[model samples]
Target: MMNFRKAATAAGLVLGIVTGLVGPAAADVPAAIKERGKVLIAIDVSHPPYGMLDSQARETGSDVETAKLLAEDMGVALEIVPVSGANRVPSLLSRKVDMVIASFSITEERKKVIDYSRPYGVIPVVISAPQDMGIAAPADLAGQALAVARGTTADIELSRIVKESGVNARIVRYEDEATTNTAVATGQQKILAAALSTANEVSEQNPGLNLEVKLDMAAYPMAVGLRKGDDELKAWVDEWVGQNLENGKLNAIYEKYFHQPLPDVIPES
Candidate 1:
C-alpha cells in the first residue's frame, strides 16, 4: 500500500514513458510541434501567481505549471519562452511560440488576430487609490492621474471608460505593472488601474502604500492564445481546460498560489 504521493509519482513516470513511446497525436498538435517533439509556450514571468521566477530563477507559477501540464498531456516536451504583455501576442503570431498561456484576457479586439481557447481563469481589473483620494467610482476618476501599463487590458478599459464618460482624467502609461504600482504606491500617481491580483501583491509587498481598491472596473476571463486558424491546437487546449477544471486540478493550482478558493468566474468546462 503506497502513499498517495508515491503512487502519483509512479503514475506520472509511467505516463511519461507511454507518452514518449506513442508520441504526440497528430489531431491534437500543430504539424511543426509534432515534428519538433516540443511545444513553445509564451509566458510573462513578471506577473506573480500567474507567471514568475522563483528564488532559483526557474519559471514557476500557475501559467508555467499549466503549460507544463499541457505539454505533458500533448505528449511533448515543454519550452517556455518569456514574454511581456505587449509582446505575448506578437510572439505567437511570429511563430516564435506555439501558444501563449500568459494572463491573456479573451477579448474581441484580440480575436481579430488570434484565437483563444475557453477561459481557464478570471482576473478583475480594479481601480486602486489611497483612502483620501475620494475616488469611489469611475465617475470620480475625472481630473485624477491614473497609472497603467501600456497595451494591457487595464489600459484599454480605463481609456474606454474615460472616453465614454467624457472624463478628462490624465493617464500615465508605464512599461510594466511593477513600475505603475510604484508610481501609485509612492504618491507619484493618484490612482492605478491594475488587476486585483496585482493590487494585492503591491499592497503585500509595500504595506506602507495603504492602497485599496476604489472600484471594480471589469472582470476578464483568461485563455490560451494561439495563432488564428489553428483548429488542432485550439481543440486540444480546450479539451485540456475542460478536463482540468472538472478534475479539480486547476482549482488546486489556483489555491496553492493565490491562497484562496478558485474564483467563481472560472469556467467549469
Candidate 2:
C-alpha cells in the first residue's frame, strides 16, 4: 500500500466542498497541447470498467472510451498511458502523461497537488467481506481487519471512519485490488475489502466471498486530473464531459461498466 500519512500530510487533509460545473473553452490552454495531434492520457490498466488491460492487452473501459472521445472532440490523437492508483498523480506531475483519465476522485486535498476536471462519476465507498463474516456496517467493523487498495480514496475514507467512529478495526493495505480481493476471498486475513466502484465485479467474480455490507461511508466523485495551473486543460476536459453527458454518450459509458445510470453531477457543497 502507498503511504497515506506522508501523502495526506503533503497534500493537507481537509474536507472538501463540491465545485460547480465550469464551461470549457479553448482560449486559455497551451497551443502545443491543443494542437499537439495527440492527447497523452494516463489510464489504470488493472482496474476493470474504469481502465484495464483486456485479454488482448488493449486498454478498454469507460474511462478510456471517454478520453478517446475527448481527444476526438479536440481533433487530436488519443495516446493511452497505462498507470496505477499510486502513480496517477505522479505521472501527470512528472509529465509522463498530460492528463489522467483514471478513476481519480476529485478532493480538496488532491486539488492542492493537481487540478481536477468536472466529475465523471460518484462511487459510494463500501465494504466487501467473505460469506461467513456476517459483517454489515461500520460498527460491525470494530476489532476486525479490513483490506484496502494502496492509494485509493477508500483508504482515506476508511481511515476517517475508524478514527471518527472510534472503531478498532485494523486496516491492512494491499499493493493492488487483485491481492486484496484474493486475500479476502481465500480467508487469508479474514479482512473486509473496501471499494469505490465495480463492487459487482468483485462480488460476481468471488461468488464464495459475499459482500456482507453496503456502507455509504463516502461518495467519491471521480474525475480527470491535470498538472496544477492547467486551467485551460481543465476547462477543455470539463466542457467535453458536459457535451458527452448531454449527448447520452457519458451514460452509455457508465452503464457499460456499472450496469446503471451515472450519478448526477454533484457540486461541492
Candidate 3:
C-alpha cells in the first residue's frame, strides 16, 4: 500500500500520459479512459457556492468554477454527477464518479477508505446557545441537554470532547439541522445545536434564529476525495489546486461565496 503523498506523485505521471504529454503509455491509449475524454466528478448540488442548483435549476457554483479549471489543467473535459451527501462515497468506490468536489471534510476515519487532496478550506465547529441561555463555552453547557445531527462529524467530535474533556453536556441527536436549529431558536433545549458549517448556514438563512458562536471546540478541514488508490486522479487534482492557490483564482472563488479571501494556509493542527 502506498502513502497518500507517494500515490499522488504517481498519479500525476499517469495524468501526463493521458494528456499525451509524457510516458510510454502516451502512445498506447488506455482503453478504460480513451473513449471517455471527461473527468467524472461527483458533486453535492444542494451545497451552495460550492455546488448547488441555481434559481433556473441549473447546476453551478464556486466548485463548478474550480472543477472547470481543473479539467482545463488536466487537458480533459468534465462530466459532473450531482449527488447527495450520503451517496458521495458509494459513488466514488463504485466508479460512478472519478472525483468528489463536494464539500467533504477530511477525517482520520475517512482517510482510511478514500484518498483526499490537501485541504482547501477550514470550517469552524461552534457550540451555539441562545443569547439568553447563558452558555458561553463548551464547559458551560455541561449537564444541560444539547442537540446535534446524528452520524455527523460535529456529533462525534462534541461527544468525544464531552467524554474526554469532562464537559457536563448531555447529548441528544436530531434528525437534521432544521430541527436542531429550531429547537435552539425556540429555547426548547439549553443549546440546540453543535455544528460547524451547517449552523452558520442556518443562522445566515434564518434571521429569526439567534445563534451565538462558541469556538472553544475543534475546527475541521474541508477537502476533495477520490477513490482509494486512484493515484493518477489525486495527483492531477493536487497540481490543479496548487496552481489555483498561487494564481489568486482560489481567493476569488472563496470571496464569491464567503465574501472573503482564502486564508494563506490551512492549519494542519
Candidate 4:
C-alpha cells in the first residue's frame, strides 16, 4: 500500500532545498522567529483528540490549543500548516514550519534529524476491532487485514512486529488517519492500527459501531520537533513545556480531549 520507492524519491527531491534553508539562523531560531512575528507549526489535523478540524472547519484539539498557548507565550502569531504524518520532518527541514507540535512522537530514528522538546504527552498506540474479534495476541492478527494511517510510528512499529513475527496479516495503509478510521467504521476494513484516542474517536463519532482496543502496542511520548542544531529554541521550548506541565495548563488541555488528567510526571523519550 505504501510505495517506499516513491517516498525515497520524494525525500531526495527535497534534500537540496532543505539544505539551503538551514542557515545560521536555524541555530539561533528564537530570535529569528521573534523577528518574523509568527511561528509556523505543522500539525496533522486528521488525528483526532490530538489534532483535528472541528465541524466548522476550525482547528481545535489538544495539540492545536497547546500551539496557541505557545504562540501567546512567545508574543507571536500562530500559523498552523496542515501536514500529513509522513511530511512533518520535511516541512520543518524546508523551513515551511518553525516546529511541529502535532502528536509528534519521539523516536530514535527521527531523533537522528530533528531535535525534540522533552515529552509533553503520552499517547497509547493500539490495534483495535470490534469486541467479537477478540484480538488477544499477535497471533490473533494473522491472516487479518488492519487499516493504518501511512507513515505513522504506529504503522512503522506494527509493520516491524508483523514482519519479524512472521504474521500473515495485511496492512492496509491510507493517506491519512481520517481515511483509516473511516474504513474501519464503514465496515470496509475490520481492524485498525492507530492511537487509542483515534480509535475512541471513531467509536464515539459512529455510536452504533462498538470499536474497542484489542491490543496495546505501546504508549509513546509526544514532543515538539525542532530543527537540529537549534539548541536555543529547543531549550526555550523545553522550559515552556515544564512550566505548563507543572502549572497544570498542559494537563488541563490534555483532560479536555482525553477526559483524564495527565500523569504526575510525563515520561521522557
Candidate 5:
C-alpha cells in the first residue's frame, strides 16, 4: 500500500494527465468548496466599519458579518483569514484564501486578475486632513503629503487625479489601512486618502487631530473577489448577493456599520 503523501502525489499526477487530455477544465470552485466543508475568506480587520475587532477583541464588522452570513447560507464552516488591505489580492492569487470580502471594490485592473461578485456595499473615498487645511480640490494637494493604503482604490484614484491634475503632492503608501490611518493621526502625515468610514474611525480614535474630509472623491461599490476562472463560484456568489440585497439583509448589515443605506446604483463588472 502507498503512503498517504505518495497516494496524494499519484492522484495529482493522474488528475494532471486527465486535465491535459481534456485540454482545459472549467473551475468547479463551488464543488471544491462543498467537498472541503469550509470556506476560507479573507477580511481586512484593520479597516473599520468594513472589518475590525470589537470591544471584546473578537472579529466583527460589516465584511466579517457578511462572510459569516455567506458561509451560513452555503452550509459550510467559516474560516476567517485576517488580511491587510494590500494582502487581499495576493492572498487570493496565492490560494491562501478562497475569496476576499475585505470591502474590495471592483476595478478594471483587478478584474484582469480576478473575478468579482455583484456589488454588496459602497464606500466613499475621501481625503481627510486637519479642519484648517484648504484642500478643497485635488490640485490643492500639491506639495502636501497624502498617506493611503497601497493597492486600494483610494490609492489608485488619488494617484490618477494627482497625475492628471499635475499635483506634486507626495503620495505615501502603507501596507495596510491601519498604518495609513496612523500616519495621519500621529501627525507623521497631515493628509490621508481612504474610505470615509476609515477616516471616521481614525477621527474617533484621535479626536485631537480633528481630521475632516477635505475631498469627497467618489463612492465605490465593493464586492467579493475570487480567483480568475471561478465562474461557478462567481455565479453562486452573485446570486447569493442578489438574494440578500433583495431581502434587505445586506442593507441591514451595511447600515449597521456604515450608518447609511446601501447604494442604489450597480456598476458593470
Candidate 6:
C-alpha cells in the first residue's frame, strides 16, 4: 500500500512537470509567476467561510475556491500556503507566496507596505456576546472581557474603539480566529470581536452558545494583496476581479460558502 502511494505521488509529479512545460502560458501574467507555472496564494486557513481546512484537512472556503478559479483562469496550478493574520503581509514581502487572498482587507495603513486589487468582497467586523451577556453596544463592553485574534481587523478596530471611547474592556488576544471563538463559546470570554461570517459560523456550530452580534464595529472591503509595486501581478489580479464581478462568477463562489447571496455593499471598483 505504501509503495502504491509513493508511485502515485511520483506519477502526479511527472504529470505536473509535463503539463507545466506544455501548458499554454497565461497572457499578461508576471514573469516570475509565468516561469513557475503555478500561483502560490497565502490564506488564513483558520478563518472559516473565508478560508479553512475541511474534514479531510484539505483547504476549502470562499477564498480557497476563488483562488482555485483564479488559477484556472490564469492557466496555472494553484498552490495554497497557510498563513496567520500577522504574517500574511510579511509572507508576501519575503517572497514566500506570490499573492495573498486571505480575506485581506484593504486599508490605508496596509497600502504603504503592499498593493491591493480592487475590492472583491466586503466583511463587517462585529462584536458578539452570549445572549444573556447584556452587552448591547460597544460602550457596554467596558470592564468586560473581549476576545479577538491579534493582528486582525477586528482586533485593530476593537482596540481603537476601546481606547478612543475610554472603555476599560479587557482585550484578550488569541493567536487565531478559531481560538478566539472557542474562548467565547467555552465561556472563558464573554465577548468577542470578529468578522460577521466567522461569528455566524461559530454560532451555528455551537448552537447552545447562543452568541448574538452586539455591535458592528466596521465594514471593510477585502481584496487580494500583492507585493508593493508589482504592477504586472497587481494589474492581472485587478482585471480578474473585475471580470469575475461582472460575470457573476465571484458571487457564485461566495454564495456556495456563505449560504446566502453576496452582499450588495461590495464595491465594484
lDDT of each: 0.79, 0.71, 0.66, 0.82, 0.83, 0.81
TM-score of 1: 0.85
Native-referenced Cα lDDT, model 1 = 0.79
**RMSD (Cα, Å) of model 5:** 11.7
**Candidate 6 versus the native: TM-score?**
0.87
lDDT of 6 by residue, 71-153 (tens): 98887899999998888889999999999999898777788888898777877899888788787666788778889998889
Report the error of model 4 at residue 246, Å.
1.2
Q: Residue 54, candidate 6: how far off, in angstroms?
A: 1.6
Score every model by TM-score: 0.85, 0.83, 0.74, 0.87, 0.87, 0.87
In candidate 1, position 54 carries an lDDT of 89
Q: Against the true structure, candidate 2 has what lDDT?
A: 0.71
Model 3 agreement with the true structure over 1-269: per-residue lDDT tens digits: 56433444465567566675443223332234446887788886655556777789887887787777766655568898987655677788888987887767777877788899867766556676645667665667667887775544676678877888698668888754456656655667656454455566656765565666655467667778887776765655665654455556766777787777666556443
lDDT of each residue in 1-269, candidate 1, tens digit only:
56433543454456446544222243346678879999999998887878888899999989998888888878889999988878888899999998999888877788889999978777778888776778866688877888998778888789888899888889899987667867776778867888888888877877777778888888888889988888877866765665566566877887887788666445322
User: What is the C-alpha local distance difference test score of candidate 3?
Assistant: 0.66
Q: What is the lDDT of residue 153 in candidate 2?
A: 76
lDDT tens per residue, model 4, 1-115 = 4343343334334632664422222223488888999999898888887888888999999989999998887778999999988888899999899899989988888999889
Q: Which stretches in model 3 have alpha-carbon errors above 4 Å?
A: 1-34, 143-151, 166-197
Collision count for each candidate, in order: 0, 3, 5, 0, 0, 0
Tell me which residue pairs clash in candidate 4: none
Q: Give the alpha carbon lDDT tens digit for every residue of 1-269 in model 2.
A: 43423432232222111233332333234577766778899987677778777789788888888888777677778899887777788899999888998878877778888888867676677766655766666788877887887787777788888898898889998876667767766767665545546555777776766655556667777788888887767766766666566556777888988788865444441
